[model samples]
Target: MTTSFPMNAGDGLYSYSKNSHLQKEIIDGAKEMMRDVIIRKLDIKTILSSSNTLHITELGCSVGPNTFSSMQHIVEALKDKYLYQDQVIDSTKSTIPEFQIFFNDQVTNDFNTLFRSLPVDRFYYASGVPGSFHGRLFPSRSIHFAHCSTAIHWLSKIPKELLDKNSPAWNKGLIDYAGASNVEIVNAYVAQFERDMEMFFNARAEEIVPGGMMVLVTPISGYIRLLRFFGSSLMDMVNEGKLDEFLVDSFNLPLYLPSPQDMTKVVEKNGLFSIERMELINIKSNLVDEVDAKTLMMSLRSAIEGVIINHFGSKIAEEACARTILKSKEISEWMKVNYEKASILFVALKRK
Candidate 1:
């Protein structure tokens, strides 16, 4: 098939790779949206009422270079908030202006790599926090704003089904994205996301100060065909049977994306916050440039990590990654639909 972005890099710094041209575009797009969201909601006067000591946290913060652009945008917005508040400053602002940042993610997260890239001279205080954000990572009522981008979907590590014998969601009679038909499997994964989100907010409610804000940009479900087309196409490969052996031996497996409404319910049910703004930005799967093959690989990897190994076999996993990248080359033709054009950006505030 034909592709534009590079899809060849496997074991290298993706952010520095040339194939990341389109990936860069996507990240930049996210950064821009973040800036817009901050300006639209974050009440500077209220936040900097007294102390500039607003504490911020970013979950799933990858390497510093990966999120550097977005973080810069966030800081700029806060500064603007400060400026706006300063103009109207009376003797009564309650919040302090000192900003301490918490950068959190799984322990295996490349904290050293990310920390190495941080701007040493930056004004804010940043510290690496290792752990799952869904759990209690921050002290109660200690955080002002908490953000997680493209990360929460990782549900408490993989389910034990892959290792246990009695689990219905595990291997055997009912094959998940790892075996053949994954409608049941993907749905189960999505179900977990619903719970993860619910817990995220409930825990966040305790961590975030009242009136604090949060913004998250993640892969949201809206495309109905994506789950079916991709899910079943792998099923077709399984029917051929070459794919199954590869999948079973692979180190990982695929997961699911929950719908927008489903996510909203989780947030509302938890009662920690209210959705302030939700924007759906569409991305044509084809628009993912080939030049950033690793970037694209990582993007798809997060969603379909072990599926290819199950369907195509480990022997061809690398090539499958190539083919996987090329497979999207015909994204326009895959479902004869607009392939992957819509994405979501959510902004909310902690309810008092």
Candidate 2:
């Protein structure tokens, strides 16, 4: 059963992209979980057919530093794997394996900063390809391995009710908890997600070699877990105003939090991949700590200053945001008094 919520939470109201430092920490955790897959199933040896050469691609890759770190780790891991087999590590970096890495995302992503963040000798090749990962980006079986972290859940773009004459099907059902049955809108979101994911796999089907491996780590949940956790009190609190206006801001931002089973079905229907490893991890988020939250909150220039303004007028939203922070004193008190934590990670993979 799909448990639905009132569409009152602010959506597309913030840019969650600037928190690269916090994102790096999450990536580190993901790397630990996925390292084995990269080595064994999606091993460069299988894709490259040579011990000394490999190709890597990071999709929806944001800044280059974290992307660079991940690639370096993969390269090192592979080098270590081959060391025992080859009896000696290559001295000449160029001779060991020419690691060609492509860090791709939207063309508008901060490529300049990403480039500056990279070290002198990081990638053999670095280029920006601007397009949705759901569509074609690279040639058939051109890249050895692909990895994407914390980025796939994004809808190509948020559905816009710009005209305001007749709202979208999804938005039609968006209502308060008192009137919480937006089946049309909810179904639309789910349908779009399914289609987009299918397209994503189809594109990957063409790009990933027959034996290539891919890992997709996103914020996900079992439908039961979602309805259980969110339905229990998350919605009630919002209805009661305990969470304020943007209460759903952090809780339900994912496009659709699919279960492990849900994802397995998605892969199965696609017919081009196989599930090798799957795990539900409690990932720390781009919001580092209490202090980090403040920075992240402030870093949301548009959320703080723009979206809120458009939604509820600038003056009122600003006042509300400020008051929300002041009222959150209880949240801080509760954190110290009680050990309250939230699980923020979901991981999955497909190997051909």
Candidate 3:
């Protein structure tokens, strides 16, 4: 039930910050959606005027830089809203409502490093909340704005049925269900997603005040086919006796890229939130033409290394990573031509 594997830490060699190119794209996509809702539709002026304090929480905030970037945007947006009508408001004098911001992720997230890298003169009072977003992490009606980017696609854990050898849904020799071609495996993934997303929405509903907004940005189903192809190459290694088939068979990433329709259903079914805006934002992969395989591999490793190390141990994890890096050129070549088609969904909802 835990989903807290964090990116490797430290500057110049971290899992996420090292892959700044991809993370920046994710931030830009999320920002575009926020502009449409937070800057335009949400009654921030009214909300600020009525409350003495505002609450904000970011889910799945990996260590440093981008997390700070997201917080800055959210804080500034609120500040700008307050200044629109109250021109005399002085931020230094505390004229606007104070902010209470919480950074949340799984229990094992790198909180020490995240805290050390905090912005020096931040306006909000910041704290860390460690828990899986699949369940509630805050008190009822406590939060005003909630944001999660490139994170929800990760499920709490791999579907249990997929691990059962006798089960029809057993996903042998595959790291992800994306483009699985098998009906049972695909159905098992869909069913698991539905359950996890329901928990996410319901939990957020309890914590977010009515009329509050939550923006979720995540890579959709498009990356699956490409990933499945790259994964096949790893299997080829096992086939040729370069690697163990047991390692490949026992590994299954706990990620499910939901379609837009699937997300809509969960939001409606939860009944505590209303969908305000939902659209796919295409993200062109720069790694294709640039041949930046290291960045690509680091990005992938950050997200899944914890799972790999947990299941196969560090030595095997290192070997698997080495093989992945060795074969990255093939993926890079395909991605260059098809990168522009990669898209992420930006969904804005209002707690109701």
Candidate 4:
């Protein structure tokens, strides 16, 4: 079975903690929007009715400072809402809810580095919850607010059919469904994404309180083209006979970038949360504009090196990344044309 591995761990040079500037940019871009959503849409009174403590969970929260920054934004927004309410209503009735944040990710994530990087002057209690967010990770009606950014595109596992020799979906000489000519291969990925998303919604529906809010920021299909180039780099290695073609055939990325329509259908099928907002947000990045090979390689490696190492071993993984850096000109050209239109899907939902 294909297992989902954690991002590159530790605080080393190539670790996700050190090389996640792009993701940090995305999170920073979303902060104002998230704060607005919390102030306008979040039913703070209802959330505080049950208890004085507010429970927030960051799903797929890899090693910090991104997660730390996001949680701080949320806490500040909540406090602002409470303070604003005090000005309008009776000041004596105002109560700022205490924050308890749960930093969740796969079991293999670097929790040590994450905690070590935590701001010493943080305002909330911090705890690490290691497990898949596709399944239940908290008690029923426990979570007050949930946030996931650029992480939900990852599927729980690679589709089994892609690996079966007898299956029509057998993905030979490809690493992902993106840009695949085979309709069967695309269908296999879509099927897995639908299943995993359904499970994710079901679990979150049970965990989040009725008035709780969830904000999901995920890359849509437009982002998948970058993965195509990564696949091409591996194919180049295959042609040079440095890597086995069979290994490439068996290896596939366990990630699926869903369109807005796809996300709507699955959430509607679950029938528990109200979709408050669903829109495309353009994340500005200098890397997308210029596309320096070494910089691009480090970013991609930080996010996916663990998955590649798990499948292809460390030496081959290193070489594959090096090959990807060599093809920077090609990647840069593609980005110049297509990167301008790439936007992340941001969905805000409220438990009903």
Candidate 5:
């Protein structure tokens, strides 16, 4: 079975590993949602009482110190709930149950570096489980809580519809399905997103026990629109003879940003989970006065550099396709004039 997906898993190279400081809002948001959902929605007492071991899994936990921070928040909350339910506090004796944390990502992930860098004071029994979250990675009814942050926007793979030469959706000169005037192309991308989401929810449903909760932190539709606009601008640059069109045709990111309503539909259709809460928030960059082109370049590169290398050989992506650097510079200049904002959605759900 081919489990390959466009992933960023080089030790400290991935944007996920580097954007901890820049993307602190989302990270903190995920932690807050986990606490709120567990206390207000999930049956924490039942989960603690039913099993001697509590299972918490982080899907798409890229090589990160932030993941550890998020996990710590979760493990601590679980412990607090268990202690409160017990109605006793023993300073010397342990009242809380032991935790088993599974960190999941792609097969090519830097698990070694991730594991080696784990904090010595970590509370849970940590384990690395390499697999895509779009498919089942754990046994049925095994997990109590599932957490994913800034990851699900990534589709499991590129939509085959885009690659079909004869199909109306055959995105030829354009690298992305975004900004395509053709309704068929837009439908193709939406269809792929729906399918990937269904797969993601279905697989998670089987893994999480009834009453378990999942908190998904993903990009909102507006963020995707901005990306599409950026991608379209890049294509326009190629068309204007400023950049090579072949480079644009050769690269496309396998990512999607769905509306909160779209996400709710997938959860409802799946029939295994019920929505607890969903909210979209706009995250504005602190550098409001100026566009940090160099910073943006680093951020974008860390996230998709691996994908660039994978799709177009490293030499082509770096050397031959030097215009990409120019494109990033162009994007940065555009960012200066336009107020760039990232809208993200936080969804909390409970398995039925």
Candidate 6:
């Protein structure tokens, strides 16, 4: 498996910390649904019966601000559940549970930046756990509640078949399977998604207690329209003889946005979590004029600039990003008609 790349770190102009407003918007949009699900579906009594502390894990938590905001919301929601929503009839059972928040990501993620950006008055005791969420990161049955937002779409690695010249799945001169005319390339991506999701569910199943809850907020396949434009920009560079076609042929993004139906099948097949709620949320509704091409490119670049730099070196990657910016007006015009196609998938699952 290829090593996972971290987001652009630090507080620089191009860092993820500065350009993650899009992800923050998605997290904000899902806050109400997440709170409602926790109040109704989380078995607080079962969790409190075993321990006075609630262990919450945020998978794929990159360098701060958004991750901090999401965890704070969860902590407050759990407090509301414990103090108001729980059906514990005994008057003496009103004690609140202590919160332990685990921030998880790849080992290479900038934990120093994440730690420095943490909210000073936060209620939970925070700890950073570095590892892939596709495998176990904590002891078995240790987590009480798990949360992952706008991150589950990342596959553990790019499918190797896409790099093999002899394979039908070889994706030449393309950075991603999105908008690919070849079914083989798309199939290879889908296959990788299924395998990675299985590993993810299995690992979480082992870590979460039997009555624990997990909420996942991720983009649907339609979100790939933005990436398709990014790929087009690189291809445009290739045609202009400014970039080597071989670099484009060899590099592929290790990401997949699954449909709601696709996620349901994966959850059911695992048989460890029962679906509580699943729905498509219109991201456009959350941010109106903010979906313009320039803003989108900034967010996209912050998230994947490190990957590009690693694959094509700094000079070529910087040129590629600049070229994409030049096409902003055209992309903005396209967004006027097709923006609504993009949506976020929010899912609530209960451990069985």
Alpha carbon deviation, residue 242, candidate 1 (Å): 6.0
C-alpha positional error of residue 200 in candidate 6 after TM-score superposition, expressed in Å: 0.8
Please list all clashing residue pairs in model 5, or write none if there are none.
Answer: 15-302
Q: Which stretches of candidate 5 lie over 4 Å from their true place?
A: 1-16, 19-23, 88-94, 225-247, 287-291, 319-340
Name the runs in model 3 displaced over 4 angstroms: 12-14, 45-50, 85-94, 240-242
lDDT digits (tens) for residues 165-270 of candidate 3: 8888777788888756678988888888899988899899899887788999888886665556436755877888977887787677778888899899888877
Q: What's the true lDDT of residue 68 in model 2?
A: 78
lDDT of 3: 0.78
Residue 85 lDDT in candidate 3: 41
Q: Give a tens-digit lDDT track for model 6, residues 1-352.
A: 5377888889998889888867887898799999989988886877667578999999989996999889989999999888773445666666778999999998999999999988899999999999989888999999999999988888888888998988898888778888788899998988898998899999999999998999999987766777766788889888999888888888999888889888998999889899999998876533224345777778888888888888989988888888786778777776777765567899999889
Tens-digit lDDT track of model 5 for 1-352: 3335433555554444664443455677456666866667767667555578899999988776878888999888877776665664444555668899999988888787689789899988999898888889999889999999878878777777777768787776665655677788777777877888898899999999888889888866544433443355556666677667666665667777778878887888788888899987666655332245444544555566576677656664454234443455565656655535666788998888
Question: How does model 5 score by TM-score?
Answer: 0.85
TM-score of 2: 0.68
Q: lDDT values of the candidates?
A: 0.57, 0.54, 0.78, 0.85, 0.71, 0.85
**Better candidate by lDDT, 2 or 4:** 4
Q: Candidate 3 at 273: error in angstroms? A: 0.5
Candidate 4 whole-model C-alpha lDDT, 0 to 1: 0.85
Can you give the TM-score per candidate against the true fold? 0.73, 0.68, 0.91, 0.95, 0.85, 0.95
Tell me model 1's lDDT, rounded to 2 decimals.
0.57
List clash counts for every candidate, in order: 41, 4, 0, 0, 1, 0
Measured with C-alpha atoms, the lDDT of residue 215 in candidate 3 is 91
Worst 10 residues of 2 by lDDT: 1-10
TM-score of 6: 0.95
